[model samples]
Target: MSATELAGTAPAEANRIGAIETRGIEPVPADERTGGPRQLFWVWFAANISILGLPLGATLVALRGMNIWQALLVAALGSFGSFALVGLISVAGKWGGAPSMTLSRAVFGPRGNHGPTVVSWLSRVGWETVNTTTAAYALLALISIIFGVGANSVLTVISLLVFVALTLVVSGLGHATLVWIQQWATYLFGALNILVGAFLITKVNWDAVAHAPAAPVSVVVAGIGVIAAGTGIGWANAGADMARYQHRHVPGRRIVAAASVGAGVPLFLLIGLGGLLSAGDGSLASASDPVSAIQVMLPSWMAVPYLLAAFGGLLLSNNLSVYSAGLTMITLGVRARRVVAVGLDIVLTLAGGIYFMLIAGDFYGPFITFISLLAVPITAWVAVFLADMLFRRHYDPRGLMDTGATSVYWYRGGFRWSAVLPWVAGIVVGLLFTTASTSATDVWFSGPLADSWMGSNGLGWVVAFVVAGGLYLLFGATTARRLGGTSSPDPTTRPGARTDGEPAAVRP
Candidate 1:
């Protein structure tokens, strides 16, 4: 039986609402790839419309010491530029019809792909945890406003459960459902967000915002890197996860444009709003619970509606993360249904949300630390993957799924040294310039070059990208062209068999 048969749905019925998507890491058959670039626009737009961007903008002004104009510029460049890379990489999904990490097996080999896959999975889970905690806080604050009940340990636990359950309901239904929800939800919450934003504008101290001091050009450059790492770099790994459902013939530029514009517009506005809000009151950047912190600026009636919108926006983001994490888990060789994988990921997210909300006590410190540390490996993986895409126009779908010695990607005991070595070298070099700190006074880890401009500005991820991508292009381009040619027959016709016709022993 074909992979789609195993998924228990006809091509027509595959992505319908209320259907639980049982497909694992299998490359989506061409018939099932029906969506256009517009779908991608909605997917990315809904995913980023959350209130989280506000805190990011506030961080720019309060922590990075950028004025409002500088913050807006940084927001535009960082969010659009980073997601443009995301859009570029998403083109691979249209070619392979597989999840991002699954397509990565073509470059990294099956066994060697595990390291980056693990990091990608962890990043997804971490983001889900953060979203869950934030949503739960919004719920608690809403309850406190409605019922006159303050947050307690019990309320915290209950709130977390509520948010997690809501996420599971949408994510567990899978792709068609998520796509549908993302579109309609974007319309509803996007309008509500605009309404709330209009109210927020009245609260901004325009005089304070206008008079804010401009920082040095060096600070602005550093600010751009920080915002990029926090916003789009964190999302770089999951670019192809959603695009897997897009039609193979969809123009790559359209894909890129969809993702970049869909995400960038809202992020630019929200982050700028955050900078504006922070100019009047800098507390949002430092608050232990940001949902509660922002409430002080709004009236009681607007507060309830705003918090509800926040909760819904967070749900939108969390469900997407959970869905993608489920796919990543399957790509990591988990032997279970996709919904089962989603449940497992959510359990970890729940634990993390509990600990962070009840135990950690400090939010921004740990969040900044998390973004700084993980950005290196994810960026390194992204670099190698994008560089591989330069010469490798087609993915041998059978080779992507085949783990046996017969697979073309079974290079050198299932490790593509050319790609793997560059990836590792990138991470190592990136870390040499990385310094992670939980607080101003507390340093978690500092590399040899931590005091240098790149280190201080958090450009280690950029260095990693350049090192890994440049090295791959220099050393691996010739081999990739010879191996990853488009001469093979289409994948749909011969599902699991090798398309290259060469004997397995002669692959390398």
Candidate 2:
């Protein structure tokens, strides 16, 4: 078969597209693998150190009545657990040099993996739309304030196209350029945000923070859930996408530490900043836009740089989302080239951004809904992936990436009931328990469980990981070693199977 014929939306080998990102889902050849734990950290930081997490923190204060300190604690709690998983998934990247979701084929059958890939794709698109809309709005606001241009349909459309074009171009250029941009952009944002944080510190009213009516304990718990769900669970699916480029022998500890610290710090600090802002002077509470709201406290010179950072952060956020979306586009069984898959993703981002901005009466309502909705299945999938890595120790990126029907991942006509069933169950649990009240809409799709107890703190995603992990362990204990057990290879095992962690002493 031709190399092109063997790939799923494969990019041509040895053919450099905009910059050097020649590899697709195929295992990264040892000679081509580059970077280390620090790169993963910065990659995650660049993607995260944005104005996005501020709103999540603000929601805790504005809607849940959380104090700044309380919000900080909960935000830390959120970022702490989520980024740790990012670390774990980064380890998976060392073992399997493929796109993050492609590893789902190792858990689910190639065909069955489609279900999770679809979820990943939907989530990336949703996030891309959100990032694009916010960035475009920032640009429109900049032009209006700096250039005296008024906001209008034409300007909005132009700004959206501009952001879409920039992000798409960067993503289309592929990984090398994306990583370089993230490394530098994160440094810029980190420095600027520190200055803004210091300025905000001077203006903070300690009385407001200390005297703000303490939220109910239940409300506090729910607030933790909101912050954690929005910030942590949302990033679960994309963990390995960044780390897969590392050398396999690089210590997993470094990978996990770097990524966890990189992601966790911004989320903790910035969300705390938002809660602090919302608690005092009511600037966060009163401002129309999340990114620029805090700028009201800064001098013109400071605000300009802060605003630019906001724009950069948005582009970085959308750039990563689009890259992931491209990976997912290929997983949908398309045989077209990688660039074609990315183009399809760009089209979706544009269409979705325009629709939400123009037609969706309340974008934040659906945005929050989108995040909460995906948390469960994503958490569940992560649990299974981690469990497989820890106990059932084998991976086959070559098999998963194969386009031929003969691939070992084509189990039971490409469906793994063990993985799919639990994922659906977790989704049901999420639907039953997820609830959060937003200004635009109260009770954005909650079920009896949430109303009966826990308010909007829906801990279903936690339960999902526990439940799905336990079930997969059960399935693996009985089914085969290849499914995450410690036993001799079975029909599922191929000659080239990468058995990184299997030890007979721990065999099931």
Candidate 3:
């Protein structure tokens, strides 16, 4: 089928303006895959150009004790390097034309994929909730600056509702709409951010930034780990979700470049600026309300635009997350339309936002703890998924959608222990070196090796990735090749065969 025929065959509402996407967990037809790599650039760039990076940078200086120069280097390395992995994994989406978790059916069997899918869903929901809370704070700050009304429970609820509603509108519209919004929004909000950023630079105390002592190499390494976990590692699982729309012919290198450069450039600038701001005033790192904290540094005249840009940025990020979370929900066996899944995810986000905004005692404390704990499993999954990607280039689309016993991915009763064992072992090893805390004095979970160099340096996620990928390559490589090889039974005759007449791949 040609592009025109494929588009005509699709439901009119699919990817149409103001229409909820109807597709769920199935491979998008190759003829319908119209997007290219450049679109991915905007998608990732816009998703990441949020004000959240500022606080991440603040943490590096205020909590981790790094100077501006060291912070910049860490920001560059962590943001670019981790996202490069994200881009690499995205290539699987192009090959399979399915969401990330759906593609994983080939590596871990249908049932076995659940563990990583659940973790990915939780991570997306957590991040969306945090984005909602932060965006709400920005809206509240805007109201206070414009109308002189102080924040109260009523305003808090209203603000959260507004952000969540906006997220639903964009994310619920699904792929085409998100791709369009991310591109234009990146232009509009990206420019506004630069304007606000320039104004912010003038406020920096260069003397303080320049004179601050450089952090020791160990802390620098730790800062890199912190930045990587906070920025790219958190985004790794969702990488291929957006890439499912891209044409399979697009070079894998282009996909990787798009994600790395697009996200890396802005992150480095934003994080470095954050370090500069913190160098002058330590308040940003410890600020109870980050929106208000950053607002204090700007002149009253610049407050409105700054807050608007901040809100817009967070909305962009949240939309992508909510969209991915919805896909993840379907991958987790939620029987509903994609839009319906998005609505369910938003309900959880609203509840989490209310707790963090109105009931929680501290923000950064809990925020850091959330990142620390979730990063381990997410990284472990990424490692195993990327490892699987090495040997399995073409995904058997029918096998991916078919969860029954006849499915090629039904290795040993719906589970592939080769992948499952490495993933579980990775998480276990990671947690041993992991330490999570809600505050300096309020420790959440501290492993036996928490005080060791890897633990102390916040490299548990790194250790997890290495262990999982290495172990998979060592023990699971042959299994992966055998399972993904052309010897598998033909899927075209299967019950779940592609009705669209797309050719089947030999391996998944």
lDDT of 1: 0.86
Flag regions of model 2 displaced more than 4 Å.
Answer: 1-20, 213-219, 280-288, 295-302, 403-405, 436-444, 480-508
TM-score of 3: 0.92
Point out where model 3 deviates above 4 Å: 1-13, 477-508
Number of the predicted model whose TM-score against the real structure is largest: 1
lDDT of each: 0.86, 0.72, 0.85
Model 3: worst 10 consecutive residues (lDDT sum)? 1-10
Q: What local lDDT score does residue 210 receive in model 3, on the 0 to 100 scale?
A: 82
- What would the per-residue lDDT of candidate 3 be over residues 69-159, giving only the tens digit for each residue? 8999999998999899889988988988888888887788889999999999999999998899999999999899888999999999999
For every candidate in turn, the CA RMSD to the true structure comes to 3.2, 4.1, 4.4
TM for every model, in the order presented, reads 0.94, 0.89, 0.92
Model 2's lDDT to the true fold? 0.72
Candidate 1 vs. true structure, TM-score: 0.94
The TM-score measured for candidate 2 stands at 0.89
